[model samples]
Target: MTLEFDLFWSFRSPYSYLATPRLAALQEEYDVKINVRPVYPIAVRIKGFFKQVNPLWPPYLLKDTVRIAEMEGLPYAWPSPDPIVMDIKSGEVPEEQPYISRLTRLGVAAAEKGKGMPFLYEVSRIIFGGVKGWNEGTHLQEAAARAGLDLAELDALIEKDPDHYEKTIAENEAAQKAGGHWGVPLMVFEGEPFFGQDRISHLIWRMEQKGLKKRS
Candidate 1:
């Protein structure tokens, strides 16, 4: 039987970007499937989350993510235009988030089309891999094409019933919390949660214990 896991991820998360490439590799190399459950970032999902965080947390996070990306040998940088609309200093997330809302919804649309992993990996690379103005021009369009999907088609899917996509995003957030972590890169296999990009090894270990095998 093929093992499967639900990956609760966010487009705005650097860790999610860091985790994606290896996750993509895993599915190709092993007989497993990844259900990419895209969710809004904590900045939007949890009110006062950033403000409540320790003042040192932000800088530490920046330092940690950069090092992790380097360790993983994946190109890394913050998104050119951050997906979330928020004030960094005050840690205030605005209600009107134009970028993340669409991205997260489109993630659901792609997943519905069975192109979740590739779509996530490709789009995220464009966003977090130092592409300037990643959202402008045809960066996303090109990324979608590389993933065997079309950006316009996915956008049209969302437009058909945007509420459907929004509902899925919200449901993913709820499932993330129920899966025992409100964090991105949360991987849950058979109800066990491994949270963080660093925890991907642990997840693989568990999968191997359960007889995971390389694909033919």
Candidate 2:
């Protein structure tokens, strides 16, 4: 039997970034295919999600995630500028979520061309894997190239392909309807949704229980 699952991911979430290496390895070790589904992070999807986060939550997650990264021996760093919805002026919390919308659209566009997973991994590395100022042109272009994608082509596709982008978003929503309750780095196995990087091992264990057949 093929052990496959959909991985819903957010570029802005550190957890999502932290989740990739393990998720990728699972695909290799278990010979399963992980469908990389990119979605806007909570900050973009929910208007006040960032502002509503408990003050302690950010620092705690940051520290804990770093420890986890250390344990995994993967390169990790907290992006200096941070990937959050910002209200630069007034210092008041408000929705400035267009950034993630663009990212989600791009993600969907790449996925449409069967390049979604690779594109996301490269992009996430720049965004969360400690590359400074990922928004700059050079970094973005390099990430695109590394993923075997043409920057110009992806841009054009996103600009002229509303139907494709909308279809990707619709698919994500449909997956949620089937019971995925959280952001990217989530995998659904046998209709059961598993969220977070910590759950990957558990997912593998479950797949074993279900008699995941090794590739022939």
Candidate 3:
């Protein structure tokens, strides 16, 4: 039987961006499926998230992500016009976010069309791969095309029932918490959660014991 896992991810997360190419590669090399479940970043989900955390966390996170990208030879940069509209200096999240909501909803639409993994990989790469104004112009449209989706069609689909997508995101978030973590790139296999990009090897080891096979 083919192995399967649910990846709770976020477009606004640098870690999610870091983990995706590896996940996509695993899908190619093994008889497994990754159910890409995109959710809003913690900055949005928990309004006071950054405020409550240690002040050192953000600086450490920046250094850690940068080193990881360098260590892995992955091109990385903080997204321009971050998906979550927050004061970087103040650690304050705003009430109105113009980017992440639509991006997350469109992730749902892509999954509904059976193209979720590709959609996540392509889009996140553009966003986190140093593309300035990644949300502008044809960047997203081109990414969608690469993922075997059309941006306009996905947008239209969501416009028909935006609430449904939002509901799905809510359900995914609830399920994510149930699966063990509330963070992006949380990979769950048979109810076990591997909650970081650094845990991919651990996740693969577990999958191996479960009889993962090479794709022929």
Please give, for residues 124-216, the per-residue lDDT of candidate 3 as tens digits.
989989999999999999999999999999999999998899899999999999999988789999999999998999999999999999999
CA RMSD of each candidate after superposition: 0.9, 2.6, 0.9
Q: CA lDDT of 100 in candidate 2? A: 67
What's the lDDT for all of these models?
0.92, 0.74, 0.92
Q: Write the per-residue lDDT of candidate 1 for residues 1-216, one digit (tens) a residue.
A: 899999999999999999899999999999999999999998888899988998888899899999998888989988889998888879889899999998999899889999999999999999999999999999999999999998999898888898889888889888899999888889999999999988988998999999998999
Candidate 2 — which pairs collide?
Answer: 8-184, 9-184
Model 2 C-alpha lDDT per residue in residues 15-61, reported as the tens digit of each score: 88888877766666676777777776666566656556677877798
Give residue 216's error in model 2 in angstroms: 5.7
Off by over 4 Å in 2: 88-98
| Model 1 TM-score, 2 decimals | 0.97
In order, how many clashes per candidate?
Answer: 0, 2, 0
TM-scores of the candidates in the order shown? 0.97, 0.86, 0.97
- Clashes counted in candidate 3 amount to 0
